[model samples]
Structure formats: structure tokens, C-alpha cells
Target chain A: MSLRLAVLGAGAVGGSVLDLAGDYGHDVVAFADSSSSAVDPAGLDPSAVHDRKEREGVVGDADPEAVFDADYDVLVEATPTTLGDAEPGFSHVERALGDDRHVVLANKGPVAERYADLRALEAESAGTVQFEAAVGGAIPVLSTISDLGAPHVTAARGVLNGTANFILSRMAAEGLDYEHVLAEAQDLGVAEADPTFDVDGIDAALKFVILANVLSDGKTEYALDDAEVEGIRNVPGTALDLAAEDGRTVRLIGEATADGVRVAPRLVPQGSALSVTGTQNIVQLETKHAGQLNISGRGAGGPETATAVLSDVSRLE
Target chain B: MSLRLAVLGAGAVGGSVLDLAGDYGHDVVAFADSSSSAVDPAGLDPSAVHDRKEREGVVGDADPEAVFDADYDVLVEATPTTLGDAEPGFSHVERALGDDRHVVLANKGPVAERYADLRALEAESAGTVQFEAAVGGAIPVLSTISDLGAPHVTAARGVLNGTANFILSRMAAEGLDYEHVLAEAQDLGVAEADPTFDVDGIDAALKFVILANVLSDGKTEYALDDAEVEGIRNVPGTALDLAAEDGRTVRLIGEATADGVRVAPRLVPQGSALSVTGTQNIVQLETKHAGQLNISGRGAGGPETATAVLSDVSRLE
Candidate 1:
């Protein structure tokens, strides 16, 4: 059965989902952005919707609220991350779940900031929520842990923040300082103009929080504040050089264990799985039975994150 | 709901499964070895069963045929790997499937040697087959692909043979020849006394065949003969030195694509995901949408393989 999808946030990631929906045998029936909205109870032509968003800069003139009553089996939330209130994303998720629509989230805010509320919403609603794209982009880290079951997962650790990793890796390789590499990353569009979230460890901490919630199978709750966060902004080039000399590399590692969650720069052996560089993400699940299983891939990109959203839709089926 | 399992092999893998069954909320209702079998419809005590196997050298005095009529929900096939005929393992799986019981395989024979037959058996039976343990011991490689839906996976590549990898890694790190490392691996119990299947790359080929079958969602059939096999038997220490000079490492990689499946020594960069050392296995899936996903972990071990079997049980749920 093909899913009828209503997508919120017609940005790159959400638009990419619309672009690939047809290939995955799904129809995007509704779309909404912060400024504009569109809806088709029957089924909207994905190409037509995509073209409209690309050329005209708006999906349709329909009121954004129309998505609440719009005909869709699943709601794809790809809104930007907002920590405190989880904003329009959280509200969008609430309305979708309240109306009995399955939700596939690429937005990190609703998951990382308000996990407890999200779980409560899911518990009372008929529709389920899936957020594979929220954490490690295209990597199915959440599903892997969930599939293995809560009892089996002992811990989850990885190089979650791509921008930080990119900077650290370059600094290590070229003997350059942090500011130089950060500037280079920004120039290359690898790091955002305001790289606080990426560099300050908030991004990795948020991902670790989400992973912890998944590992607990929603029996427990965690928030950004709960984690002890430490980004790579303070990691020295000398440390990376010394580590490299010892056949190791410094990586911005995020970990979630039974005790707590933390994100910090750590010295990983050069050939270790966690020593992945660039815009790559790796999640290593320490299982009681299975040993350590490491999954690595492109952590973020329009098409890549969209692939995860599409995978979530398939999972809903 | 607890799964009632009948294990067909009282060796380490099977025994480990029995040992850890209770923790996963599973009950080993029956167990059989080459010489003896045991059955308790109510459920066998995991600790007792483990002790009996370790101390008494046999699980029970009943004939092996007793397992055929055993009351169980799933059959755990942990029998030894017999490539050609796939013998007792194949027959055990066949009988279990015929009886409409779910089968979780740790044995590579039934999967690698008789994939087509296995698929046919599954199609005709109400019970499904899961074999995460067959390829990568504790790694959830099969389930990861299956969960993403086979349609998304375009190709799969991996360092599959643990013994070969152990030997190769030791050879590379210690600047020892294959012969020297092989002996050390055997002494460390990492490789078998007569390690023809592993050294000859047949073990890796078998895993590649199984992964290919999975990538195609069992639509395509593959066997041991289908792969162009090459092992790490002839890898010299000099070659490792040469590769290292260029920042590359030689790994016994098994690859399955639309073109063909092959197991051979490939030059993977030192920091590459496939450059896993020792007995670690890494499977990289080339997806049409999700980009490349790399999963690495222990490919084979008694307890680790048992974890995969237990995970398969969870997947059945």
C-alpha cells in the first residue's frame, strides 16, 4: 500500500523526500512550509509539487493549518531544529498524532528536547512516530538498536557531529589550528555560519540523548540538559598531533550509557571505527550478546537524510 | 511472549544460546547434538542445560530424531558448516520449516549451499527463516538490510572471514608471513586446526552468497560455486609493507553486486571501514538512496554468534 504523505518544511531535506517519494512508492499529498502550504486530498503529482517549490518558491497558497485536516497517512516533519520549545515542529507533530497520522521526523528538536512528551503523544494516539533521519542522517542507528531490543544494548557511542569531526580531522592532518580549519569548513559549506550547535557539542549531545531514549525503549527520558556536553571547540591541534604520533586520532565522540550521556573530544586509535573523519557519522552499539556493532555513513545531506525519511515510511508500512 | 526454541546443535554456539536464552525471555525447549538430544515441552532450565553440556559432554540421552517432533516455536540451527551437501543442517532446517516452525540459523551450509531451496521452503511454509548468525556472528547485518527493505540495497561488500582477517591483520601489524600468523591464530583458538574453508576464502564466499541472496530479497539465488573465490593464503608480508607505504591495507573482502559475487584480497585504505583488523567483520551496503552504510563487528564466535541467533528470535517477534 502506498503511503499518502503530508510534508512540513519544504526545505532541502523535506523537498528531497518529495522528490524521492514516488521512487519509494509513496505519494506526497500535502506540503507546507513556514510561509505557505498546499494540499491535495487525492494525490499531488510529486514532480509538479517539487517544481512549484523550486521555481515558484512556495508549494501552494493553501493555509498552513490545512495540513492538520489534509488527507495524509503519514506526516514528514523536516523542520529546522529549535531546542527550547521545539516550536512549530513539536506542535506539528502533536497535531499530526492527535489526528491519527503516522509521523516520520527529520527534525531533531521534537525528539531531543521533548522526548517524553513525544512518547506520551505516541502512546495515546493511533499513529506511530519514526525519526531515523533525526540522528545520524541516513544511518539506521535507531532502528538497529530498537531491532536488537532494549535488553541487548549496553551503550551507544560515535562521531555524531559531522562539522566538528571535519574540523578536527583537518586540524590533525594539516597541523592547522582550530580557527583555521573551522574557517575552511565554513568556506566549504561543511559548517554553518553559526557553527555553535555543531562545534559546541550540542548537536552530538542531542543525538546521544535521542539514542539513549531509543536504547531505553522509551521507558526512560532524557534531555539536552541531562547530558554532560563538551564540543571540540577547545580541542587543541597539539593534542591531535600527539595522538596521531601514538597511532591515534582525536574525534568528537558522543556516548550514551546506562549511567549517563556525554559528548566530548576523545583520542581514538587511528584505525578504530570511531576514528572516522569528515562529514561521516559512526554509531557503535555495545550489545551484551552481539559485541560491538559499528555503523557509519554520511551523517547529513539533503538526499541522504531524505533517504532515511523514506526508509521510515517503508518501516511504517 | 516468550519463544520456545529447539536447538539443533549442543556445541558452543548452541550452548551459548541456551545460556543466554532466559535473559532474552526465550526458553530452550529442546536441544540435540550429533549423538544425543533432549526435550522438555515446559522449557529447559538454561543454566542446567549449559552445565549438562559442559560437564557431562552430552545434553541428553534421547536420540537426535527426538528434536524433529519437539514442541517449539523456532528451530535454532547451530550445526557445523558442511558446504557440499549441507547435510544434517539442511535436513534439520527443512524439517523445521515443513512443520511450520520458525528457523534461526547459525549454520552457513543451509544458507550458502542451498539458498534457492531454502527460499522455496520458506515460500511454502507459514514459518519464516532468519539467519543473522550465519554470516556475521553478533553483527545485525542481515536484519539491517532486511529492515531497510531489500529493494533499497544495491550491493554489499565486507571482510567476512574472521580467521582469515585475524591472520591477515596479524601479518600486517607484525610484519609476519601468512604461515606464521596462521599458526599463531590457531594457537589463540581464533582459527581452526584445519582451516581450509577460512584460509581458502570459502568462508567469506559463503557469507557473500548469503548477503547477496538477502540484498535481492531472496529473489536471486547464489551458492558457493557462483562466487569467484580467492583467499589470503598467498598474501606475503612484503605486499603488506608495500601497501602500508601507500597508506593501504590488504583485507579479504567479499563483495556481491548485480554483476557478480566474489571473495578476494582487496586493498582498503588504512582508515577505511573495510580495513577492520583481527576477527572483526565489516559489511558495507551500497543503497540506492541511503548512500553507503558500513557495519563492523565480530563475525564469528560462540557467544557472539549466539547473540545473532537470539536477535533473529527477536526479529521473528
Candidate 2:
């Protein structure tokens, strides 16, 4: 079951996947960052690649396009997610599928922005696509849905964005305003410097969009633009304080159904399953016959997301 | 993809499975209670069977043993759980597997008490044994473990019993003594006439024992006797009040690892994910590299448990 992987993108998720693939009994035959490529038919040493990427500006001396020419069983798309065209990530998946190679994606752009196109490509290719890492970091949301059968699952909703959740939970616990907490989060490396995608609910919306597409099973296609999204920026500390007075708490909840997707700050009862705190994430699935199922875990991290990617790689035939 | 099912036992789970099987694109060819059975080569009408059972106090005029003679692709073992020998249910499973036919169990005794034997029979048969309904009712606990690959999961801990959880949550919320809550639960039909199995932690222990067996992947066999069990019979309202004063509450928590299984009423943070309220169940899996994954849902019920049974039926090749 060992697979030869050509991993694209050298960020934390990609680097961690390359570093941990060997532990999961997989070999990295080709790897590339935006500007550089490292290719080898035989497995490349992860540490050697890491050391080269650290000391030198590039991962290797080979051209970036050389990864397409290398022998690989799956294309690991871990590149930074783009909004509209989905860039080289989408193209990388197309090329891999065209070559009849499996694709495992950590990038959200190709999935969230262009789900129908991605699936159409998958329909024509012998290779399948799996992107467990694109949704809930380490949580097995997609697989659970698949196991339960998508048609049986009525809707999916919960805390998806860890940065927003962390900020909201911290603000509620400390009684601080949005501005103060965002500053503290940036200083603590919990939030990015710009922080628009993570804070403005786009990140969560994209995930729900992907979920909607999956749940609809190609009956309806969903994109980020179809979602009704609202972030935590306007959720003041006073609103949280009022909620706490009534024995409730606020969480950045994202919901996805066949109809549409919505991400907003909502009040949940204190100590409820949906009230996961800090950097934790949760997904509550409303099933047709079974009652609600809640799955929560570390939603975002280099190693956490990498485990999901590795799990996907292991699931491939 | 339509499967021919022979459902055993006339209890809630078995009845629900018979009632809902046709909706899932499956046909029930044979159904049995202790005294009688209804056998039809062409599918039996669920309402007709129910009507006959209601008026005549039997499912049909046929002998209960006639179920084996009828054609069936899967045997649905929903018989009441019995400890030690785990008979009737175990024998039913053995006969189905012996015939190289698939078996889906809603009964806990065979899985919780005789896991090694069941797995051994499965190994020799062309059919597979799936018992998702045996633990956590409708919650997809076992399937999640299977997807994560049992070796990658370090431990599983949570609230697996609903009746016990309902009593505990009621005691904590109403500030009532254990006796008062037990009486109220009995009046509400939440607790059975004999609540010893649930209130004594044996029910949750059985589930954790099954979880331990699955997580170990046959490396270790766990039985009810192997678990160190403590129930909520001794947890007074005063203890819950004292814990609540300090932002904590008590829950009947169960833990299972490669080492052993233990179930006890433990204190958890008031707003933590583990502190799910009334009749709800939650399982937190400590994974090797993916961090902790929590799955919570309704642990028991007729339609709820039936969904898990039907889900298992759908998974059969």
C-alpha cells in the first residue's frame, strides 16, 4: 500500500506531509515549492530536503515542472489556496488526473471554488480524489459523512475556523473586545498578520461550501459566492457578556445544507457539544435517521493537518 | 444493491430495523420473535407483520427456527444482550457466518463479551461482522476507529450510556438527589423497571470493553470483568453542587486504552466538550498524530440504533 507521492507546496502543511510521509509508509519521490522542485525516482530524504530548503532559498536545483515528469502515484496538493482560478493547484490536480494518478488535496481553492470542475475531472480519470485535510484539520468529517452516506446526512454545522473560535472563546473568557484579542492572537501566532481570511469567515465559508457540494452529491454545485457569511468582527464583547449572563456562550458556527452554506457567530448553550473552546473545532451532522453527531478536534496545525493528509494517502487504492 | 434481511428478536431495535429496512432499499424476507416468525420469499409487509404480532402475540405462525430456512443475505441480530455465554445471539451470528452470510449485530453481548470468538468466526467466513450499533447506539464510534486504522488511535474515552447520563444531567441541573432523579427518570420511562445494568455502569463498561477490543485489533481481549466499573449511584446532589461551584460538573466517564478499560463518575469542566447534557453520548479518541477527535450523539433509541444497523447493512459488499 506504499504510494509514491509528488507533494506540491512547501508551506507548513506540505513540509509536514513530506516529513511525516515516511512514518506512514509512503515515499516522497518528487517535491516542489513555488519556485523550486526536487525530483527523484527513488525516495528523497525528508531531512535533506528540509535542510536544503532552510540553508538555500530553494528546495533543489531542478526546475519546478520536473515534478510532473517524475514517477508518482499521487499528487499531494498542499499549495496556498487561491480564490478565483484556483491556480496551479487546480492545474496540478488536472495534470495528475490526466495522467491517471490519484490526488490528495490540502489546498481548499480547487475544492471550494471549483468543486464541479474538480469532480468532472475525477469522473473522467481512473484516479480518485480525496481531500480530508481540506475541511476539518485532523477531524474525520468528510470520511464520517462518506461512511454514513451523504444522502442520509441532512446538514452539517459547527465551529470550523480555529482562529475565529480561539479569538471568540478568549474574548468570552477574558471579557475583551475584538480589537484587543486580535492583537493578542497575532502576537501569539494564533492569527495571521493580515487575518482577513481567517477572521472574516471566508475560511469557514469555503469549508462549508465544500461540505455542501459533498452532501448534495453533484445534484447542486456550491461555490464560496453562494454562501451567506458573517464574521466575528461585529460580535462585540458586550454581546458575549449578555450571552454569558443568560448562561450561554458565543461560537463562530458554520452550517451547510443542500440549500446553501452560512457562517456566522451564534450563541450556543454553555457546556454544550458545540461550545468547543480555544483552537478546537467541531462539526455537528444532522442525520436523517440517526440523531445529531458532533465531531470536534484540533482544527488547524501543521502536524494536525498533516495527519489528515497522511490518513487520506493511506485511504487511496 | 438490495439485500435480503432476516431480522431476529421483536424488541425496539429489531422492530425498528424491520420497519425501516425497506426504506433503505433492503427487503426483509424473514423476521422472528422467541415464539414465532414471519417468512416470505417475496418480502413481508412490515405493517402486516406488526399487526399480526400485536393481535396474535406472534410475528407469524411459522416456527421461530424457520428463519434459518428462509433465504437471507444478512442476519440482523437485535436480540437482547446476555452476558457470559452470550447465547442465542452468538449462536445466531455463528450460524450466519457459518453459512458465509453477512451478520449485522445490534446485540452487545456477542461483541462485548465474546469479541475474539466473533472475529475468529469472521476470519474463517467469506462474510464480515459489523457491529456499529453495539456501541454508542447510533454514534459512529467503531467505524471511525476503523477509518483511522486502530493502530493510529491511542485511546478512547467518553460517555457511552444514555440512561446513566440522563440521570446524572438531571441531578446536576435540578440539584436533586440520585433517588429523586432515578424516580423521575423511571416515571418518564427513561429508565427501565430494572435500571441496575445502566446505573451500575455495566452498560457503559460493555461498550468500552468493545471499544478496547476494537482499538487493540485483537492484540488484547477485554470482557466485562476486565473493566473497573463505578456508577453514579453514589454521586449525590451535594457533590454536583460542589463541583458546579468551581466551574465543574460530574459525568459518568469511561476510558479504554491498550492497557485496560475503566468507567467512573469523574469531574469535568462545566463547559468542556466532555460535559454533554442529558441522554447524549460522546467519545473522545486520542489519536497518535491527529490529536483528540470527539464524536458525540444519541447513544440509544429504537430508530437511532436502527440507523446504525441499516448503515452497517449498506456497508456490506
Q: Which candidate is the best by DockQ?
A: 1
Which regions of candidate 1 fall more than 4 Å away from where they truly are? none
* Per-model TM-score (chain A alone): 0.96, 0.99
Tens digits of lDDT, candidate 2, A161-255: 99999999999999999999999999999999999999999999999999999999989989999999999999999999999999899998999
Q: For residues B153-214, could you state the per-residue lDDT of candidate 2 as single tens digits?
A: 99999999888999999999999999999999999999998999999999999999999999
Question: What interface RMSD does every candidate have?
Answer: 1.3, 1.2
TM-score of each: 0.97, 0.97
Candidate 1 structure quality by residue, lDDT tens digits, B133-231: 998887778878876778888999989888998888888899999888889988999888999989999988988988888777666788888899998
Q: Let me know the TM-score candidate 2 reaches against the reference structure.
A: 0.97
Sliding window of 10 residues with minimal summed lDDT for model 2 chain B = B269-278
How well does candidate 2 score on lDDT at residue A239? 98
Among residues 3 or more apart in sequence or in different chains, the pairs in candidate 1 whose N, CA or C atoms overlap within 3 Å are B137-B299
